[model samples]
Target chain A: MLAGSQNRVQCTEIVLFGVNVAMSWAAVQGWFHKLASPPHFYVTAGRWVPWLGASTVVLLAVGLGWSLFIAPLDQYQGASTRIMYLHVPAAWMSIFVYLVMAGSAAVGLVWRMRLAEVIAASSAPLGAWFTFLALATGSLWGKPMWGTWWVWDARLTSELLLLFLYLGFMALQAAIPDRRAGARASALLALVGVVNIPIIHFSVVWWNTLHQPSSILRLGKPTIHPSILWPLLVMAIAFKLYYMTVVLLRARCALLERERSSAWVQQIVTEQIALCHPLR
Target chain B: MIVDPQTSPRLGRALRTVLVRDLTLALRRRGELANPLVFFVVVVTMFPLGLGPEVDLLARIAPGILWVAALLAALLSLEAMFHPDYQDGSLEQLLLTPHPLAVLVIAKVFAHWLTTGLPLLVLAPLLGVLLQLPESATGVLVISLALGTPTLSFIGAIAVALTVGLRRGGVLLSLLTLPLYVPVLIFGAGAVDSAAGGLSVVAHLSFLATLLILAISLAPWAIAAALRISLE
Candidate 1:
């Protein structure tokens, strides 16, 4: 009788554990749907904006301060080498944000998720800006280091091509009048870009690239001094935070645009007007 | 879909029907057929004039010039690949059909290559002589172009499909496609450049063939998706 009761207890425990697993799985799915929905995501993202913005600003200030004032000068390249802080981080963000944009694009395409579409669309201009920043800053540094302005190096060419890809995406989106169709169409292009980007990166290696090899992303220990590497890494983090803050803000704007006729947007607009004009 | 596109007899019949229909349509407008080929010739000629009739310089640059002109010619014809079908309501009919849209897209792209890319391939040797391209290198140039232009047609069709719904998609189509064309240009011209310089052309040709196979296998689905989006 005691043994029977113990078996019963064990079976009850097993059933309860299975029940708990099922419930949590359902809850996670529910949370995902809630987050993916536009109005829900809008409210949630708006709440995140100030925090993201504050963190970004704080980190950026510190990163810049450390990068310019605190970091020691390289004995060989001297002051021009300091451009590494801006150039490397921007370059990293250019590729990092492209992956984000393309990944969101794929999600938006496959699931037809509205917030994913907004995130994908919002990320394009930021990626382009960082790419152009990287290119421009790298060129400025190159003129002094390499004795010329451009060499059509592998990374340089691929990055320039990446900028053009971003432009093409934006242009395609602008040309399409139907919002959903436009988003999905550009999403398709981004998927294709993801496939081709690696080819672009490697194809130009056949050319005798004069650009310096990567220092941080390679295998084994990074070749740079710890002090310089830290500031650069800190700057990378700050740029990433900046991207997150702006993208969330942009996603909110895009969501508003996408859902302009919805009731929630209408209520938010009216509330904003009332807040702006208290007398009214 | 039920019978499987590969084993079923319908796939072959469908491919032939589209190919014949496109070729017949292209033949009906014989003057338009010559436009890209003639454009290819004129563009090649302009290079000699712009750079002067310097044989050595022309020979040095012929591979790049011919490859680029061929690419542009292929691009010029690409806008028509689906625009006409889309306008005539056949594109909608195509989507509604039970057959896979990818098969139809590839058929149309193949017909487009036959009309545009083949002519450029045939004319490449003549232009090679005009550019004073090395006699030995001429073989490599023709072969590489023959291998490469079909890939361009296939890839360019995706852009055309995406742009077919827009009124002014001409410039937009080029902007979308030119970056994608870089790999083909590199390999096609690289093959000839290497051949002219007495370097082995094996690597470049293999790359071109690999790209062609990739385009053949993958481009149709992308074109079909783009066409669907445009229609939507």
Candidate 2:
């Protein structure tokens, strides 16, 4: 009898666990459905933008200040190493934003979601800017260390390819006249370009090793000092927040343009017009 | 919806029809068929003139130059891959066929490779000589082009399909496809370079082969999807 009762209790626990999992999954799905709606997303993103923007400014200021002033100079690189804070974050964001864009593109393709498409489109220019920044700063850093403005180093070469990928995405987007078709086409390109990232990285690494063994110095160590690591980490966070702020702002503008004929957008436009033309 | 074997031939038959149709169309436009090959020769010849008649320097960069020219030549031919079909309403008819669109797309790509890429492959050895490529590396250059150019056609088909609906697709097609072509160029040229240096080129050849297999298996589906999106 006691054994039977124990089995019953175990069965009840399993049932409860299953119920909990299902409930949470449903809740997540509900949240996504709500977020997928344009008006809902517009309102939510607008509310979050100022907060994200303010945090970005604060974090970037603190992080850059800490990196430039408080952090000790590298024993080897001296003050020239200061560029790491910007270069590293920009490089990191370049890859991170591509992944995000690709993810949103996949979602947009699979679910036919407009917001995901907008997010993907909006993320490309930002990704390109970050990639360009990384390349520029790396060149600046390379001048002193490698004695040349540019070398076909593995990382830089792959980063250049990444910039091309971004340009291709943007160019595809601009060429198509149909807005939705353009989004879908560029989304497909993004998905295809994602595969090139790893290939570029590996090929560059292999090419670098074969040609120049000791020419380009790697940026950071596996065991970085805490003082330097913390500032770099903080700067990375700041860049991410900045991406969020900018992407959201761009997506909101895109949404306004795309949804101009919808009722909610008309209402918002009327309110703005009323505010602007008080005499009328 | 039952398919009668007598009334409707099998999917294989449908695919063959697509292949034949594309080949026939390509053959009718001899100028279009020969354009990429002509471009390939022109680009290869220009390199010797532009870089001076320094045989040694030309020979050193031969593999890279040939591979890049082949890539650009293939790119030039890709714009016409589906433009006519898309314009003539045949693409919509193909989409509506009972057979799988991917198989039909693959057939079209195969026809494209036969017309454009095969000519480039045949012409590469001649260009190799012009660049003063070592005699021994000529075989590897031919092999690499044969293996790599099909993948280029397959991959370029996706980009061409994506842009086929647009009026100004030429520049966009290059922008979209060039970066993707880098891997093929790397492996293809690397193979010949290794051969020129008397190093083992088995690894590079294997990479090219692997890329070809992957592209052949996957790119048709992507092309089909892109076509659908564009048509819509």
TM-score of each: 0.93, 0.97
**Tens-digit lDDT track of model 2 for A1-280:** 9999999999999999999999999999999999999999999999999999999999999999999999999877889999999999999999999999999998999899999999999999999999999999999999998899999988899999999999999999999888888889999988888876787677668767766798767755668899999999999999999999999999999999999999999998988899999887
DockQ of 1: 0.70
Q: Please give the distance, in angstroms, between residue B87's alpha carbon in candidate 2 and its true position after superposition.
A: 1.4
Query: Which candidate leads the pack in TM-score?
Result: 2
DockQ of all predictions against the true structure, Cα-based: 0.70, 0.77
Question: What local lDDT does model 2 show for residue B76?
Answer: 95
How many steric overlaps does candidate 2 have?
0
TM-score of chain B of each: 0.95, 0.97
**Candidate maximizing lDDT:** 2
TM-score of 1: 0.93
**lDDT score for residue A185 of model 2:** 90
lDDT of each: 0.88, 0.92
For candidate 2, the docking band is medium
Which clashing pairs does model 1 show? none
User: Tens digits of per-residue lDDT for model 2 on B175-214?
Assistant: 8898898889888999999999999999999989998998
- Which pairs of residues collide in model 2? none
* Alpha-carbon lDDT of model 2: 0.92
Per-residue lDDT, model 1, residue B143, is: 92
